[model samples]
Target: MTGGSPGRQDIGPVRQSVDGSTLSTSLEAAAARLRRRFGGRLLEEAVFRGELTYVVAPSDWLRVLAYCRSAPALSFDRLDCLMGDHLPERAERPFEVVAHLTSHTHGHRLRVKTALAEGESLPTVTGLWPSAGFDERETWEMYGIAFEGHPDLRRLLTTEDFEGYPLRKDFPLQGTVGGRIRIDLRGKI
Candidate 1:
């Protein structure tokens, strides 16, 4: 979080060095563009290790990504990856969905993130980037981060009767005790 809180829209554009090595500048420009376009919907922005990350409201997830994809200044037309992080100790929102995007036209990368409370549904971005369909399904099955509006939302790597989310930080290492078992031992004994 190099810059001050960028949640405010109305902030002035950041200036880069005249020499034109503008990784930070480009990141700021993306943040500014997002801020200007999304207004208060932009929750927080940060530049870390020359990479820009924006934390946005869950309600604005699809719209923000759509803007990044379609807007000329951004044109982040590629969805590199979609993943989830679970921090169950946080009382407010324990789940985070991180989307990595790249702009072949603009020649930069940015990470968009949104936080969701337990059981909160995430708006699907598969419509914007069809490649995210299976990734979202994997995240859903692994972390239980539900993706709303996903056309075929189902467990990608687990059985239909899987009990709990496996990737949450709080999930037990040995697995849940006394979970359901469908085995029958009629004549074997």
Candidate 2:
């Protein structure tokens, strides 16, 4: 994990609003606000399919999410999705934790992403959004992304004895072990 401040420089350029509505806030504006508040902790920003996406530093993920949830102007109250992706090709950061945040009042959706190398830990966002607990646990079990500070960080999909993250790109396609034994009581010889 790279250790640095949040707002060392400004984010992407703000384009003119297409809708021309004063109430509507552009993604650039939000990124700028977050950059100012967090100060260089936010790593990158981009727009995809009209959704604002920000790649945040791992160390600052919790702080950024907490602010986004509690701040009245930027109340990203709804955590629509929390998932993990594995990028084996990427040498520095092989795993990514993506979160989709929705602001019902503001009618805006933001995607926050934090990248992690193997064995690095990601802070849990369940404190800001309780729904994250399940997703985090699943990520932990599937991609082996350990979420620090999770109240109940445990396997949600896989068994306790399960080994290795199944979702990694390098994971084998074939099964390593069979499921539990099944007995045929009706046709017992």
Candidate 3:
């Protein structure tokens, strides 16, 4: 295993993090399995509300995902969801691609994230999870973030003639955006 990987063989004894809180055996096992594959490419790991999330490097995105799906030890075969986030605050890498993966064999789930710049695109994961077909298209349409290898990446929700990303933060709040239909319910529900 490479340096910065999380595992018993490489790092040894993952019973607790620096905070000294015990982690579930499954999480440790999953981390170890991932370490065996990707090593130190994992940037950060966080657990909130008992859910584990890993921040991955954009360059390693495709390989990490492939490992998650194919590795027997990790077997994260389920692509629960895939979405994109636009964080204008982070200028260097403002766009984020988040994948929710679940392993039925391990009975655990993991959230993986990778950040990219405005023009950068991620390799499509549709090859790993067929369910990601529409999700990637929808995300690309809404966020204006491209999926480089997506087979059919055309707008799924918006018309082919539509212009601009509607879900982007900077998208016009009021106006005829991409010929959108609007009903002005003047201050009343």
Give each model's whole-structure lDDT: 0.77, 0.76, 0.77
lDDT tens per residue, model 3, 133-179: 88899989999888887878876777567888877788889987565
Give the range where candidate 3 is weakest over 10 consecutive residues by summed lDDT: 1-10
lDDT of prediction 2: 0.76
Candidate 2 to truth, TM: 0.81
User: TM-score for every candidate vs. truth?
Assistant: 0.80, 0.81, 0.82
* lDDT score, candidate 3: 0.77
Candidate achieving the largest TM-score: 3
| Candidate 3 similarity to native, TM-score | 0.82
Candidate 2 per-residue lDDT over residues 83-180, each given as its tens digit = 99999777888899999999886778888888889999988898889999899988988898999898888756665566778888887889784345
Clashing pairs in 1: none
Clashes of each: 0, 7, 0
Off by over 4 Å in 2: 1-8, 15-28, 178-189
lDDT of 3 at 90: 79
lDDT of 1 at 31: 67
Give candidate 3 regions above 4 Å deviation.
1-23, 180-189
Q: What is the lDDT ranking, best to worst?
A: 1, 3, 2
